[model samples]
Target: MLTIDINKQLGDLDLQVNAQIPMQGICAIFGRSGAGKTSLVNILGGLSTPDNGQLTLGATHLYHQQQKINLPPERRRIGYVFQEARLFPHYSVRGNLNYGNKDKDQVHFDTVVGLLGLTELLNRYPATLSGGEKQRVAIGRALLTRPQMLLMDEPLAALDLPRKRELIPYLLQLAKTLNLPIIYVSHSLDEILQLADSMLVLDKGKVLVNGPLHAVWDSAEMRPWLPVKEQSSLLMATITELNQKYRMSKLSLADGTYLWINGMPLPTDSKLRVRIHANHVSVCINRPTDSSIRNILSSTIAEIIHSESNDNVQVKLAFGDDHIWANITPWACDDLALKVGQAVYAQIKGVSMTESELAQSF
Candidate 1:
């Protein structure tokens, strides 16, 4: 169990966070810039001291205001990777990696080196390493510490598209094997979706919303903040087959149903995600007898939300465990007779963004 009750002031922003992160997997701090996410992670990692708080992981009390307990950074045994690689300009890649070691320890040398594929670049200097390589080495150096938890403060912010793309898979693999809770700070929504099992959204030092990744999307609080159109549903599926003749993709969902899509990132043998936008989805009272839409799934009306401007309605539907949204006019809602528990057909015409746009651009 990782718990925090902290109050601190930085510049014009004030932070009062009281949250608990279960001690496993990755948890992201999400928000726009100036939301005080970095400060919270810094305080957890012992890089910054909070005005008053009790910070602890399991039985270990890292910070206690009443007890006047505050551990130093080195003693905290927490790994940190910032957005900038911050590799030493003068040191060789290997030297910069080993600089944080309390002594000459060989415990994590080979495994860490191999995990990041740093063996080929150990002899190279930071100036010669690519952006991705430097970040990999930075992560390797942090992992070599064998810390209790990891603090990643927007590590991909400075990297280009290719660099970010190159690092995500490795980070996923690293997270799976780390066996420790990770405090990830990120401003990108897609980054949180891809890497985080859960997230906490911050706004001006206050926790706007925090829970499972989908919880942030489900809450009414997100209705105004989210771009009206970009909001969509996340559906997990297996690539059942490739329709080479028809130039389409087929995905098999867990609910014993198959959906045909344009194209996906997965190989025919792999699993991947498919996005269905509510605005792009049309509802029908019956399975259309003469419809061009290839993907039609059974759904029920769960909720009807009006547009922020009150010009249209956003219809929410339940399909098995997954939910999808649709943007329709008030007249259309009445015409279709949409209501909770009414059987309906979710017609999928040509999607807004194809399979490629379903996720974040690399």
Candidate 2:
């Protein structure tokens, strides 16, 4: 586990964080512009020092206040990929990648290059590479160091839409192929949803909430971060069956409930992350007969949250072991007489998958 209890004062913001993050998959550090996301990452990467705290990754103590033990960035063995590629202008991609490893380990070099798809650009200079290509090289350079963990600070922020899309696949593949934990820092919710298995949300230089991506996403702490219309719920599901004739796939949820989406060519049993926006869901007092909607499940109203600024209410619907959110107007809520624990039917109008393969299959 990566355990930390740190504090620092950055100008007016007092950064205080205490948490134990699992060092298994990508853990995204997310918040607004001044939420101390970068600052926290810097401290973990040994790029910046915390005023006082203890930090330990597995068996090593990166920092300890009482022991007066603090490791420098290089000694920490943490690879950092910044927003910019930061490659040496005079060097080719191969040369830049070799800078971190003077030993010139060919096996590690080839592995990193192949994983990052950097072979084609090996002899190319940084100036000649595109934004996405440059970022890949930077990532490759970092991996060549054989660091205990990888830190990416909004690596896609500097890229345009197309460039950002180009790099996301590589990021996903890298995470799956390597055993090292990745601390990805980004403000973009879309990026976090696509890349992170767990998330650590920072607010005003403090740890707000941290947990599995889906759990944190469904928490009350995350509601304010999203616009009313953009509020959504995430579900991890597995493909159980496919209807080749209709081009549809059935996904099984934790509770054994199933949802169908546009067909994906992937094999059965593939894991997928599903996103259901609140506005796309509608509640019915009774299950509609002969309805055109393909996805409708029996649910009970678990919570009724009134909107402070509008005439709408957010209803939390519990179905078996999973829950989803629905946005409805006060008039509709009253007409349906929705109450806590009241049975209802949720008609999902749309479903989106974060998996790139199903990006256009909604």
Candidate 3:
């Protein structure tokens, strides 16, 4: 785990954070423009110093104000991928990847090149590559350093939609293949939903919430950051079966309840992360019969959040150990007389599978 209890003052923003970030998978740092997302990442990377507090990665102390120990950026063993690729104009892909190394181990270089899909472009220069390809080369160069952690500050912000789409797959592959911790700073919720395993939300230099991505996404603290229509719940599901004739895939949840989506050609038993918007779910007091909806499951009401200013109410429905959210009119809620612990059926109108291929299938 990466433990941070640091305080820094950047102009008017008094940044203070105390949180333990998981060392495995991607931990996304998210907030508004001035929420100190990039500032906190800079501190962790030793690019900027904290005014006071302690920062520790495992057993090593990267910074401690009291102890007067502060490792420089290079000595911190952290790799940074900024918004720009920052490749050397005079060098080929192979040359840029080999710039920092004295040993220049062929095995390591080949492995990183293969991981980032850069072998075909090894002879090309940065100017000849697309935005996505350039970013891949930048990632390869960082991995070749063998750093303990990677810090990416809005790495896709500079790319267009197509470029971002092209680059996301490589990032997902990296998260699955490596054991290294990646602190990703991005303002795009779609990107975070697709790439992050954990989430750290900041508000005005303070930690609003931090935990597993699904949990944090479902938390009340996250609701205010998203618009009513964008509010959604995340689920980790397993592909239990494939219907080739209908081209639909069966996804099973924690409680053995399942949902179906337009199937991708992936093998059965594949894992998928899905997002269901609150507006897409409708609650029924009695299970609907002969409905057009393809996905309906038995659920119990866990919580009801009434909107004070509007006639809308958000209901939290629980199935086994997992939960899904629904936003319905107050009249509908009152008509059903929904209460905590009440059993009902949830009609899921849509499911957004976050896996690149599965998402594109829809």
Candidate 4:
């Protein structure tokens, strides 16, 4: 496990972070800009020092305020990838990768090249490569260093939508295929949802929440950071069927409610986590006789939350042990006469099932 208990004062901002992250999968540091996400990672990478704290990875002590133990950046064995691909323009892909290793044979060059799909671009220079390609090379360089852990700070933030999609699979593959631990920092919720097995949420340099992705994603503490229209709940389900002609997949939720999502055909029996946005779900008093919406599940009203404007309210619905949120106008809530324990039908208009939204459960 990775343990961190740190207190620092950076000018006007004070940072106090304490969390234990699992050493197996990707642990994401998520928050808005100026939340000190970068600063925390810098501390981990040995680029910055905290005023007082203790940090350890497995049995290695990276920092201890009282003991005066502090490792320099080069000795920390932590690889860092920033938002931009800071590659040397004069170096070729292979040259830049080799810069980290004293002996090329020390690391499996071919394996790293193949894993990141850089075999064809080894002879190319950084300027000739696309944004995604440059980032891939950056990752390969980091891996060649044989680091104990990797710190990635918004690695995909500089890429366009298409490039971001292209690079996400490689990240997922890295997380699954390698034994190395990763600390990913990002402000984008989509990226966190896609890659994070665990999450550490920061607000103004303070740790607000840290836990499994599902717990933190659905917790009340996360609601304020999410826009009213983008508020969502995550459902763990298994893909039971797929219709190739219609381009849709049927997922069976734990409560036995089957939901159809738009996407390329996925293998049957594949486990997935589906994001159901509040605005996409409409609460109905009774099942509609005919409707275009594909998913309508029986749910119970758990609680009602009114927005600050008071013009609308978000209804918390419970399906078996699972919970989801629905955003509707106060007038609609009154017309439907919603109350705690009332049975209602939730009509899910559509699910956002992009590559980033759907992650294969290990």
Q: Flag clash pairs in model 4.
A: none
| Model 1 Cα shift for residue 46 (angstroms) | 1.4
lDDT (Cα, tens digit) per residue for candidate 3, span 1-362:
99999999999999999999989989999888999998898999998999999999999999999999999998988988888999999999989888765578898888789988898999999999988888999998888888899999999999999989888888877777777789999888888877888899999999999999888997999985667887888877878888889778888887889988775546777777788889889999888999988899899999999887766899999998989899999999888889999999999863443243233111
10-62: candidate 2 lDDT, tens digit per residue: 99999999998999789999889999988898999998999999999999999
Candidate 4, residues 80-115, lDDT tens digits: the string is 988898999999999999989765874488888889
Model 1: per-residue Cα lDDT over 283-318, one tens digit each:
888888878787788888888877768877887878
lDDT for every model?
0.79, 0.86, 0.86, 0.87
TM-score of 4: 0.95
Candidate 1: worst-modelled 10 consecutive residues by lDDT: 353-362
State the lDDT at 188 in candidate 3.
Answer: 80
List ranges where model 1 is wrong by over 4 Å. Answer: 103-107, 267-273, 334-337, 349-362
- Cα deviation of 193 in candidate 1 (Å)? 2.1
For all predicted structures, in order, the TM-scores are: 0.90, 0.93, 0.93, 0.95
Q: For each predicted model, how many residue pairs clash, with residues at least 3 apart or on different chains?
A: 2, 0, 0, 0
